[model samples]
Target: MNRISGLPRMLAVAIIGALSITALAQSNPYDKFRNREYSNKGYLSEADELKLAEQVHQELLKQFRLVEDRSLNNYINSLGQRIARRSQRPNLPWRFYVVDDKSINAFATLGGRVYVHTGLLAATRSEAQLASVLGHEIGHIVGRHGLENVKRSQKYGTLAGIATVAGAILGGQTGAGIGELAGNMIAGGYLMKHSRDAEREADFLGLYNLRDAGYNTGGMVEMFEILQRVSQSSPNALGSILASHPPASERAANTRREISEHLRGSDQRGERDSSEFERVKPSAPASSKPPRKVRPRN
Candidate 1:
């Protein structure tokens, strides 16, 4: 009777072990793509991606002169929050920072941090125009453009060196010499190219976010047109924005087509442009120097 009882207990333990293994397998998000072509390429565990983003965020804070104007910061945050609420990752801890530089630029990181140069804000004429730029950056984050590019690099086995540089950037122990190296690494190459599909998707999503946030979608077209004109006059002037993405004329055209065809005759009255926007514009810093070569890290 004792032996027979022990046999049933052993059987129960075996069944439990099997279920545990199955659960572990099912819980892995990347398992489904393990055998796929790009599965192994650029395969950063979600944990790594978040870690990289946090490290990059810290680096950004340390390297750039972050704006300290409370009202301006709050205003940008409010606009970002409204747009984020309409984004796919609404629950993310999104942050908006105003860079003190005068370059007309904006960028987004993987973990929902968006940086906008003061110059860009100064150049914009209205809240909707600003929203168009923010919407584009938001599009990059929502579309996971950086991750896709990293994956492509991984697929080609070219990401290992890049990942090493990224690791060094994140580790924060690199001395001044290596700091320059890492900065050069980030600003020198095409490590963060968003695919054409990703670009188009962001364009559409940006317009959607702008409209949802009660801004005029036409502002999207206008912003791109401004960028296009700037690019043609001196591509160097819009260095980071133009290089990381495609030509603004193409984007403007596409946006105009979408707005006309899809959102024809939409109401645009009563949209509130934050009063802070007006007050902050004149106070923003201007970049007197020419456009420097800065590689964009998505």
Candidate 2:
């Protein structure tokens, strides 16, 4: 009789242990990202992305100085939009900005916002090299990298709570806490961190964008060399830009292999430089001020 009674208690214990394991798995914030397909856009709709982008833009205005020269803005927009038109999401309200900072970096955020530091423009050897950098950034948006990373980060319970605050702000509601969370999310680099696979995918897509848009594919390879050189000489210049990417030599080698194996004719056929690029390049002098650097969360 005692054995039979103990069996019921033992079965109950087994069930309780199973329940505990299930709960722990469910609570794990990163579990969902492991098996996800990042090819498709993440949970946010286009409109929602734009709304979030607008908020982030406001936060950026507080952090960096933007070039206000009409001619410079128009030139970058025209070049960026040309490459953007060849992307998977061509109709996005594509906009580009020249950050008046002397850091060799460029980054993209939600809703087609791309920022290139003055140092990056000053560092390029030709229009093709500049366009290659622009294409790489556009490739990230084409793959919805930023949005997917943001969604993954949102799975953390406390950070998940920030979504409700984000929604409230987007829906025209306001609070100090809501605004603060939104700013912290951007300032903290939550939206900029990407996995190695994502970085590789962007490089692949960027090469295609460069090719399809009539620029020499070799520019992508050259851009990698420039990046590698700067990284070796002045490590701080790249800051967070190269932190999550593969080593520069590896990237350049891969790009060259891709060009030789698949995109053979592209390296030789396209335009290598442009007069317009020369006109706009000199205006982007490196700033005397130090750039704002933020350590990204892993």
Candidate 3:
């Protein structure tokens, strides 16, 4: 074989190195999620997630009329902080707010900002029931479920862009408006179906959070039952909530089993209803007339 010159050999080595780097960069961004810690990866770094959360929180304050009752807001904030401290991404700045809309709905965005509708709060029968709902929404945030959905959507190219842009656009709109838009966007059938596995994971994790927050785990099952009943009586009334989370009877059963197996016979002595939940009722603005019930959009 002819001896290669130093320049040619250097050029060949450089080309090989460049190719290797390109291949590494082109590898799927999701490969890391294949590990058991997948749920943990979808989140932005703790600081980044917190920053985004603050941004989203400000946007939410602008979009929705925040419940003004000081005691009510404080109560919700305390409960949320207590539960959030026990979440996987506890380092992120978490906040909870009550919206003035009279629709049975709740939602969480990319960060830790969560919104509970006045209707949902008014409809809940007990503190445990309220915690169950909040815990589930918290589950979506800590589980980084939305981020996973965004990633999966991105894999499909233009459709993914459309979905993300739509989410961002609708996310900036009013609470009821976003709820309606999200319901339609999800139902349009372009987004990847959330794996049943993910749903099960969220349910289990949410129950864990609820229990840790001193709520009866039975509340989780009760919420499901209530949703099912509502769906049967007035599907359109709960369309937004149902669209985001498709309720399953099996999910209720699974939560019940988890409770019995994991939490049965525990002390449960300190878990009592919060007076704040009892004291706070959904209130309308002082300047506004009597609140009108707004039906969920189809």
Q: Each candidate's TM vs. the true structure?
A: 0.70, 0.79, 0.66
RMSD of each: 18.7, 14.1, 17.3
Tens-digit per-residue lDDT, 17-119, candidate 3: 9999997566332222222343445434445444434544554444567666677788888888888788776766677877777667777665677788776
Identify the superior model by TM-score, candidate 2 or candidate 3: 2
Q: Which stretches of candidate 2 lie over 4 Å from their true place?
A: 1-41, 158-161, 169-178, 288-298
Clashes of 3: 0
Cα distance off (Å), candidate 1, residue 273 = 2.8
lDDT of 1 by residue, 1-298 (tens): 9999999999999999999999756522222322222221344544555655665655565567777767778888988988988876677678888887766788776657788888788778778889878887787777677666655654676534555645554465444444354344345443345666677677777887788888877777778878887777866767465455767877886676666666775424425466767776666553543333333344
Residue 271, model 3, lDDT: 56
> What is the lDDT for 30 in model 3?
23
Instruction: Tell me which residue pairs clash in candidate 1.
Output: 42-154, 187-295
**Better by lDDT, candidate 3 or 1:** 1
What ranking emerges by lDDT with the best candidate at the front? 2, 1, 3
lDDT of 3 at 196: 61
lDDT of 1 at 101: 79
